[model samples]
Target: MDDALVVGGTRFIGRHLVAELLAHEYDVTLFNRGNHDNPFAEDGRVDHVEGDRTDDDALEAAARTVDPDAVFDCVAYHPADVRAATRVFEDCEAYVYVSSGAAYGREDIPKREDETPLASCTAEQATNDSRDSYGNRKAEGDRVVFAAADDGVNAMAVRPPIVYGPHDYTERFAFWVDRVRRFDRIVVPGDGTNVWHRVYVEDVASALRVVAERGEPGEAYNVGDRRIVTLERMIERLADTLETDVEVVYAGSRELAAGGIELEDYPLYRDHPHIVSTAKLAELGWESTPLSTAIDRTVAEHLESGRDGRGQGPCRDDENRVLAALDYADR
Candidate 1:
């Protein structure tokens, strides 16, 4: 495909994916709400269609306007969103649905693309803070594209675990990075050994591109670093990257009960082992960034980017109060 339409491309993973698409010599057109500033706004090489994803008419118009060879659905959450996409890009040759590993749900074992049992999704669930609902919806979205195969939409779902890198809006990794940078002590909100597997934001973009360009339709691929890092090791890697021996404190669920702190507080804080097997996607010739290397790069990029206006952990007061209570208990 010579032309690719990115459903959204002005932020973290989407931004990096746009860069990758451009580097690969594909003409790019972006469809977004135009709320965020895109660095490529003035570049002639890119085209833009401004509208909300939920605005089905706008989406259909953009898809018809671009008439791309491939469409990358970056922000589809609900199955209705997927249905909206099918109606919009009816003529597009290839479809890449950027689903999440969350769709795989909390299986007792590590997830492989083909084996893990998936949950169900709904409109209300997709928009809420519930992980199960989000995953269920993402999974359902994947099914939407797969089921649309009879209509000739060549689609594949790219499921990702925690995606961390520069320009992340979620501040999942930023919580730890920023806390470590600003304070002598950091409170990790879990038992500190919860299993985690994260893919770099750029790595995710690259993987998505690979799927768009070469993936088998109706199939889903799991992509991430093979190395599993615990939430504790994750923080330590930030310290290691910054060359600071920050004091570490572990405040599991009980301690954080008062602060409305959930595992989501730390991006890598998984409810269970979310380690992903990249073997399926690896066969397509894409690779995930190394854990330590990716961490160091993220910390460096976050630091170089002024680290301002990014996310931080819970308010200092809340963290401090928890830390103080723990310290008193220790004494």
Candidate 2:
């Protein structure tokens, strides 16, 4: 059996990737802190190894024991993390690094796999900053992983945009869903004209699996749905799905930024024209799930979970203040 080791396999995209790998008949070993229960415990194909990827000694010990044919690094953030992994698994057959589209520094350029001028920041500075530091760190991480690849050890990176689905913790899209379900008046940032590229979590998982099977060594692929949707249209679609009538209100980006409202806090900001092209992945025979279908499935699953109890509850005093401030500022 071809053995695979997945770091950070207990959550979100990592869980889905592990499932896909098992389905493809790859013997899987997962490494995490094991604080969270394995969602795939019943699958019976996974071997669990508990360790911290940041801990060199622990990671080296786990890598020696698993000695996997390939390593799918699902949660490498800092460039130092990549350097740490290289120290441990220098001889692994394949090192698949899960990177982000944020790696591309050019806000002027719609992100593509082959694009140059990759954004990067020193690892030390990245640790303190939040907003743009993530992409910068990921770019550095990608560089380290690709540089560390060898003739025997193939390395590849996957850059995915806003991934959403069942276990989504970001709740970025969920905030919109909840809002649309309650009120017909939708408040958007910056004319709701930003173009967003979103991919279903399942599609992202499938793409990773395909890349593991056939992706070229030392190449990076952008995996996302090609269809672009504006913030207004996305909300409209959500309203249509929920059978709700809503009014769309647009706000300037400057106003929202000045009010200290984070773009991630609202759905509209995600629509900004930072679109990514998947031409390379398409050539690799990867297909993406339709945006509408993905949205429908996600909303339905989120509603059915009924974990949305918080949506209907009374807003706390501070929460109400923030919402009121946002509304006042936007208006």
Candidate 3:
């Protein structure tokens, strides 16, 4: 059996990729901290090993034991982490790094895999309070993995944008879905004209699988859907889906920043506004599901899981006030 090892297998995208790999008949071994309960216990094909990606000794031991054909890294944040993991998996057939579209500099030019210049921080020491440091660190991480590709090991990078779906702990999408359902006045940022690119979690996983099987070694692929939606239209769609009459107001990024309203700091990267083209993935024969369907599924799943109070009691009026406040600030 062809074996693969996945780091961060319990995450939103990682979990879906694990399922997809199992469906494709690849004997998969999961390497994670095992902090959460096993979500795939019913699937006997998955083997679990507890370890940290940054710990070279643990990774080397796991690599020697699993002897995987490929290593899919879903949690590499720093270049050092990638370097540490690659040192251990040098003999693997392929090493897949889950990168982000934000690695591309916010230049005026349209970004492609090969055209955009990667950015990195050069500080001698690391500080946790810096925003500029994070993306640069991720860019450096990408370089580390790309350099690790050699005669015995192949490396590929997959960059995705704003992934959302069931089991999504990011809660960014849920924040919006919950607000829209309450029939409150919505607030949009910066004229509500910024184009946002999004990809469903399942689609992202499928694209990752496709790239793993066919992506060019030492190459990066953009795995976003072609369609870009504005924040205003997204709110409208949500209101329509929920059959709620909600008013929308406009606000400036500067105003929100001044008011200490930090909607932009959300973990899901929902604050960034940019148009990303996925023509390359399309050329690779990957098809994305409709955006409406994705939204409906996510909202339905959030409701069904009883996570957002589907059956506790009559939906509280206090919920409406909280949603309205977010809506006001988001605008």
Candidate 4:
């Protein structure tokens, strides 16, 4: 497809996706509410369609204007959004929706695309805009894509787990990057073996483009790092990237409770490992960025952006209390 229309192209994944599409020589137009600043505003290659995606009229107008060969929906949080988008661009060569790995209902060592059961969404959950219902709603959106495909719409879905890298506003990963860059000794929740699969933002953008060109309709693909790492290894890798040495202090429930903190209070801490299988995406000529390389870029951009990730997790004062308690208990 030579022409593409991206809905929600100004932030995080969507921003990188626009770049990817342009790199592959696709004429790209961004359709958004104009709430956030457009990074590509000055670029002559990218065009902007100012409108809210929730308004079907505005969306239809964009479809009529672009008549793009492909459509990518990055801000579809609810099933209704996906359903409407697929309908509006049903004739496009491909319509890809950005889904989440959380859509899987069951916990497995590595969640696969076809085998894993998806979370259930109710009428109320579908309409309610809450983080608690995010997975359910995303799963329902995948179903909507499937139905659209069955009706001859070239709709596909890509599920990514815990995406991180440059321009990550979530600051979830930044919390650890900051911890390693700023401190000699940092508290790590659990025994440091906690596993939460993460994919780099650029890889996600490439996956969207690949799925648009090569993926089959009515199908969903998982995108994540080909190799997984534990929480301890992740921090160690970060320290390596920053050329620093620090002690990784493990804090359990008891140790954290000394500071009135719970393991769950820490960001990226999961009792059970959350992993997704990427063999499917790999088959479509998709690969992930190396952990070390991805880390280097993430840390560098983080330093430049000056995002401390303070609001993303527990405060340092609280962590210091936990550390002091650990020190006392050790003595």
Candidate 5:
């Protein structure tokens, strides 16, 4: 698409998507509430449309002003938002909604686009603005895309597992980056094989563009790292990226209890592995960033931003207690 509209372009994935669009030489416009600082405010290449996606009138105004060939809905948290945007931008060449892998109702080794069941959203859950209902809401949003596409709207969805990379406000991966950078030895809960699939922000940005350009209407594609890494290996990757050596200690749930820690306390730790098949997205000529390259960019940005991913994981004091317990048990 020669012209693109990115809703909520100032934050993590949206921010990266704008850069990706600009790099590809597409005229870009951002639609957001203007709360977050616009990274492109100084750049003369991008345009901004100040409006709330929640307000139907404001969104309509933006669609008219931009008359974009492609529309990327980054702030669509609820199904209703997707419904409204599809109706407003039905004439666009493509309307892409950013969905999440969490939308998969069941935990599977590798969740696929069409085979895996999507989480069912109750009407109440769809409207509730809570993390507990996030997956359900996102699933409903995907459903909205399907319905819109059925009505001739060129709408598609891309579901990414956990997105990580530079400008990640969630700071989930940054938590581990900080530990690897500052500590010689760090404790990883469980046997350290927990796999929570994560896509780099830049790759996710590219996936959005690919979906918009080449995806079929009514289709939802899963986006993630082509090669998945375990929790332990992820830390190792981070350490390698930082050019540092680290001792990755594995702790069992029972041992972690010595420090009042649970496996859930770890940001990226999961009891069951979570992986999504990206072969579907790749079929459209999309490729993920290499692990080492992704980690290098993430670590470089983490060091520059000084984001320790604080509040995203258990406290260091508690982690130390767990380490002590593990050491005592070893002895």
Candidate 6:
């Protein structure tokens, strides 16, 4: 794609995607609310349009002005948003939506591009509620995009699971990095056997480009590691990568709840592993980023950014509360 437009390109995967686009010699245009510090605002190489993606009028105007060959959407949530955005991108040769793996009906079995059932979504489920998880809503959005294939939008979806790497705002990986550091002892809920699936932010960005350039329209591809990585195994990898000496403490759920804490308090603690297959993406000639590489680079970035690699966990206080309870029990 010689010219392309990205919706919401300021942070995380979007930021990395923009960099990938530039690397491929594609002139890029970014459309967002201009509410945050843009890493690309200074680049003379890109066309910037500051507007709301849901705002039909503004998007249509920008679409006419930029006239890109392919459009990548990173923040589209609801079908309503997709409908509005596609109306603006009607003429683009390719429309790539960045969706999440949560949309799958089942994560236990290895899922393909089309074999898996999509989580049900209703228009009423549009409002944010725990009943309508993001996975189901993304399925709704995916349906909307593929439905537009009839209108010749050349649409496709790239679903990624738990994307982590540099510039991650969620602090998921940072939680591990910090836990490896400054904690003489680390705690994990349960036996730490939960399934973990994730992709590097930059690799996801690259896969998006491959999707935009070569993916079959009206289809979705899973972009992540084919080999499943368990929570405990990854933690062991983290300790090895950071060269940290810490004892791992496994706590039961009963005690955690009694202490006003849950597995959520312990970062990356999950009851089930999110097993996903990237076989489809691999078929498209997209290579998955090694977990070891992703971990090293992420830690290096966190350290280079002047972060002390200490106490970055979101549930630090809650974790301490739970840990204190465990310590009391030991007494």
Clashing pairs in 5: none
RMSDs, each prediction? 2.7, 4.0, 4.9, 0.7, 0.9, 2.4
The C-alpha stretches of model 4 lying farther than 4 A from their native spots are: none
lDDT of 5 by residue, 1-331 (tens): 7999999999899999999999999999999999999999999999999999999999999999999999999999999999999999999999999999999998877888889999999999999999899999999999999999999999999999999999999999989998899899999988888889989999999999999989999999999999898999999888888889999888888888878988898899888889999989999999989989999998999999978996899898998898887787789
User: Candidates sorted by TM-score, descending order?
Assistant: 4, 5, 6, 1, 2, 3
Ten contiguous residues minimizing lDDT sum, candidate 4: 258-267
The true-versus-predicted C-alpha distance at residue 248 of model 5, in Å, is 1.6
Model 4 lDDT at residue 104: 98
Better of 2 and 3 by lDDT: 2
TM-scores, one per candidate: 0.89, 0.86, 0.84, 0.99, 0.98, 0.91
lDDT of 1 by residue, 1-331 (tens): 8999998899888899999999999999999998998989898999998889988888878877888998988988788889878767766778888989888755746688888767776667756656457778888887888887666778778989878888877776777788788889888867788887788888898898898777987889987876777878877888888888888888887787555565466556666676778899999999877788888888888887765423444677777788878887889
Off by over 4 Å in 2: 126-131, 150-152, 253-272, 306-331
- Model 3 poorest ten-residue lDDT run: 309-318
The Cα local distance difference test for each model comes to 0.81, 0.77, 0.73, 0.94, 0.93, 0.81
What's the lDDT for residue 259 in model 1? 58
Model 1 spans > 4 angstroms off? 122-132, 254-267, 306-312
Model 1 TM: 0.89
lDDT score at residue 146, model 4, on the 0-100 scale: 96
Candidate 3 lDDT score relative to the true structure: 0.73
Instruction: Output the lDDT of residue 148, model 2.
Output: 75
Q: For model 3, how does the per-residue alpha-carbon lDDT over 112-133 read when each residue is reduced to its tens digit?
A: 7788877755753122425567
Q: CA lDDT of 161 in candidate 2?
A: 81
How many clashing residue pairs are found in candidate 1? 0
lDDT score, candidate 2, position 115: 65
Residue range 1-331, candidate 4, lDDT tens digits? 8999999999899999999999999999999999998999999999999898999999999999999999999999999999899999999999999999999999977898989999999999999999899999999999999999999999999999999999999999999998898999989998999999989999999999999999999999999988899999999999999999989999999998878888988878889999999999999999888878888998999999999887888888999999998888889
